[model samples]
Target: MGALEGRVAVVTGGTKGLGLKITEAFVAEGARVVVGARGGAGADGALAHLDGRAVFRQTDVRDPASVRALMEAAADRFGGVDVLMANAGLSRPGPAAGLAGADWAQVVDTNLNGLFHCVQAAVPYLERSGNGRIVTMSSALGSRPAPGASAYCATKAAVEMFSKVIALELAPKGIVVNCLAPGFVDEGMGRLLKQNQAVWSTYAPKVALGRMGTGREIAEAAVYLAGDAGAYVNGHVLEVNGGLAW
Candidate 1:
C-alpha cells in the first residue's frame, strides 16, 4: 500500500506549477486531494489526468470564508482532511524604498495572511483526523535577502516562524505543523526569475548543487513530511534548496 493510502489532502494553489506537482505526488501516494485555487481556470486542463483522485475547489486563501469552505469541501467529499498544503503565494518584486504600498499589501495578504486563514479553517478537520499534517510553503529567500524581494522575503520569513509557533500550539491536538522552504526550483516564480539571465547569473553559483531544483524534488520532500515518515517531525522547516550557500 502507498504511504498515504486513504488520506485526504487539501493543496492550496494546486492548479498549477509547484502546487500542482505536490498534488500529483500526494495522489501517487494514494491520497485523494482537493485542489483549491482562486479559480478553476487551470484545473480541468492540468488535473484531468488524475482520474478523479484530485478535485478542484474555487478558493481565495486571502479570504477566511473561502478558505473555510475549501476545508469543508474536502471533508464533505473525502470523509475528512488529513493533510493541508498551504501553498498559495505570490511575489511583487521591488525594493522596499520604492515599492508601492498596494504591491506590498498584495504580497503580504496572499503569502502570509492567506496561509493563516487556511490553517485556522483546516484546524478543526485536521484535529478530527487524529494524525493531521500541515505543510506550509516557505522560500530560501525567507532567510536570505535579495535586492528587490523585500515583501516576499519578509512574508516567507514570517511563515517559518508562524509554522513553528503553531506546531507548539497544535501538538496537543495531535496535529503536526511544519514548513517547506524551497530554493530556486525551475518552476513558478523561480522560472520567471530565471528568464532573466542577468539575474540568474548572479544567483546560480550560490547553490551547492550547481543547478536549479526540480518541482518533483520539492514535491517528494512534501510527501515525506505528510506521510507516516514524518510522524515524529514537528515545528521544523525542511529546506529543499540543494544546499544554498547564501
Candidate 2:
C-alpha cells in the first residue's frame, strides 16, 4: 500500500513533463489516477505506457464548462476526488516587454485563470473526501523574479497567494491547499535550458547541488504535500529549487 492508498487523484497536464511525473508518483503511491491534458498526453501511444494505471481526459482548464465536465467525470468514475494536482496551464510567451498583447493574456488566462477553474470545479468532490488536498504547480520564478520571464512569474506569484487564501477559507472544512514550485525540472525544461545553455550553465552553481533537478524529484515533493504527511502543512509555498533561491 502506498501513502495515498485508496485515494483518487487528478493530475492536470499529465501528458508530459512535471505533470506526468507527478501522476506517475501518485500512482506508485497507491492512488487511482486520472490525468488531464489539452489533447491527451501523447502523440503516438505515449499514454499506453501507463496501461490502466492512469487514464487521460481531454481538458482545457481555461474553459469553465470543460473543467466542470472534467470534475463530473472524476466524481462518477472514482466516486470522489481526494487529491487534486491543479497542474494545468502553460509556461510559454516571453518577457513582459517582449510578449504580444495576446500572448500575455494567453499566459495569464491559462496559468492563473485556468488553475482557478480546476480548483473551483473540484471543490464539491474534494469536500466529499472529508480531507481534501490541492497541490498546485508553481515555479521558482514565482518566488523571485527571473529576468525575461514575467508572465510565468506573475501567474505563479498569483498561484501562491491564491492557494493561501484557499487554505484559509477551506481550513475549517479539513481541506489543505498548497503550492509546489520547482526551479527547473531536468526533463520538461530541456527545451528552455537547451535554448539557453549559457543561462543554465551560469546558474548551475546557484542550485547548490550544482545541477538541475529531475522530474521525479519534483514529483516526490508533490507526493509529500499531497499525502497525510502534509495534512497540517496548509497554505504553504514549498520551494523544490535545490536551494537555488535561498
Candidate 3:
C-alpha cells in the first residue's frame, strides 16, 4: 500500500508549482487530496491528470470564510483532514525604499496572516484525525537576505517562527508542525533567471549541489513530514537547501 493510503490532505495553492508537486506526491501514495487555490490560476491549471485522486476548491486564503470552506471540504468529501500544507505565496518586486504600503500589506497578509487563518480553520478537522501534520514553506532568503525582496523574506522568516510556535501549542494534541526552507527552488519560477542571470549568479558557487532545486525534490521532504517517519519530530525547521550558503 502507498504510504498515505486512506489519508486526507489539503494543499493550499495546490493548483501549481510546489503545491502541485506536493499534491502529486500525496496522491501517488493514495491520499485523497483537496486542492485549493484562487481556482485554476496555476500551471496546466495544476489539476491535469489527477481527476479521481483529487478535488479542487476555490480558495482566497486571505479570507477566513474561504479558508474555512476549503478545510471543511475535505471532511465533506472524505471525512476530515489528516494534513494541511500551507503553501500558497506571492512574490513581487518592490524596492525597500519605494515599496508602496499596500504592496507590503498584501504580501504579509497573504503569506503570514493567511497561513494563520488556514491553520485555525483546519484545526478542528485535523484534530478529528487524531494525528495531524502541518507543513509550511519558507525560503533561505528568510535567514539570509535579498536586496529587493524585503516583503517575501520577512514573511518567510515569520512563517518559520510561526510553525515552531504552533508546533508547541499543538503537540499535546498529537499535531506536529514544521517548516521547509528551500534554497533556490526552480519550479519554473527560475524562468526569471534567463534574463536576470546576474541577479542570482552570486549564489552559484555556494550551492554545493551545483544546481537549483525542483518542486519534486522539495515534495519528497513534505512526504516524509506527512508520514509516520516524522512522528517524533516537531517544531523543526528543516532546510532543504543544497548546502547552499544563502
**RMSDs, each prediction?**
0.7, 1.7, 1.6
Deviation from native of the Cα of residue 184 in model 2, angstroms: 2.2
Pairwise TM-score winner, candidates 1 and 3: 1
Q: List the residue pairs that clash in candidate 2.
A: 15-41
lDDT of 3 by residue, 23-110 (tens): 9999998889998888565544456688667889988989999999998888889888999989998886678899988999999999
Local error of candidate 3 at 4, Å?
A: 1.4
Model 3 residue 197 lDDT score: 76
The 10-residue segment of model 1 with minimum total lDDT is 39-48
**Per-candidate clashes, comma-separated:** 0, 1, 0
* Per-model TM-score versus the true fold: 0.99, 0.94, 0.95
Candidate 2's displacement at residue 147, Å, is 2.1
Q: Quote the positional error of residue 229 for candidate 1 in Å.
A: 0.2
Q: Give the TM-score of candidate 1.
A: 0.99
Candidate 2 lDDT over 50-79, as tens digits, reads: 667677788899899998888888777888
Alpha-carbon RMSD, candidate 3: 1.6
Q: Write down the lDDT that model 1 would get.
A: 0.95
Please give the CA lDDT of all the candidate structures.
Answer: 0.95, 0.84, 0.86
Per-residue lDDT tens digits for candidate 1, residues 1-246, read 888999999999998989999999999999999999997776777999999999999999989999999998999999999999999999999889999999999999999999999999999999999999999999999899888999999999999999999999999999999999999999998998789999899999999999999999999999999999999999999999989998
